[model samples]
Target: MNMMGSLVALLVALIWKPDFEEWRLGWDIKLFARIFSGIVISGMAFAVIVWCVDANGPVFVSMFRPVRLVVVVIVASLILQEPIYSGSIIGTVILVGGLYLVLWAKKKEMKSMSNPVETNRTDRNVV
Candidate 1:
């Protein structure tokens, strides 16, 4: 989705003002290194995410997406010196609640699967 949006924006830019000069940001070593670092980190992160998705199904892997929001709230407040918004707090709470629910449901499912079902419910009916 992100890549598709970026490509669409690039296409629009080409149609609006076709200028190859816009791509030529005078090559500074720092700028090149920064871009390189970002690509490397992004690639590594993507590889790890792919590996996780393969090892664990998408449902289990997807639950971690909300964790990024919690991290962002902290970093935004502390590093960026931004005020903590009520929306951020609310979102964090919801994310945490969702995580707990998913974990609980998964655990319950595992437990139910692990224990064998008793078809002889005549004995259980007495209780």
Candidate 2:
């Protein structure tokens, strides 16, 4: 997924080659600074997420990703002074519910793998 995202970004950059020469050095420096900062932040975020998943297990760490959306909404409301709507709360509830279902399924799968006899018995019962 990361590779695909990077590929898409590269394709966009290749298609839209902005003429940096048109901008003054001062403005170009700010643009470069913003871009570099974004790159560094994204890289660090990815690294931390990967390390967390690796150390704590994917299901445990992945659960936090959906919750981050709720945090984002709250922060935006406070920091950016954006209005929070009822629909946003409903959507967030749905997102959390869905994430819980997915994680539950993953846990079940892991449990089944750890108990091969249960899987085999279930397979026999299906037949």
Q: lDDT score of model 2?
A: 0.82
Q: What is candidate 1's local distance difference test score?
A: 0.87
Error of 2 at 43 (Å): 1.5
Pairs that collide in candidate 2 are none
Candidate 1 Cα errors over 4 Å, as ranges: 8-23, 121-127
**Candidate 2: where is the Cα deviation over 4 Å?**
1-36, 52-68, 118-127
Q: lDDT by residue for model 2 over 71-102, one digit each (tens)?
A: 89989999999999998899899988988898
- Candidate lDDT scores, in order, read 0.87, 0.82
- Worst lDDT run of 10 residues, candidate 2, spans 118-127
lDDT of 1 by residue, 46-81 (tens): 898899889866777789988998999999899999
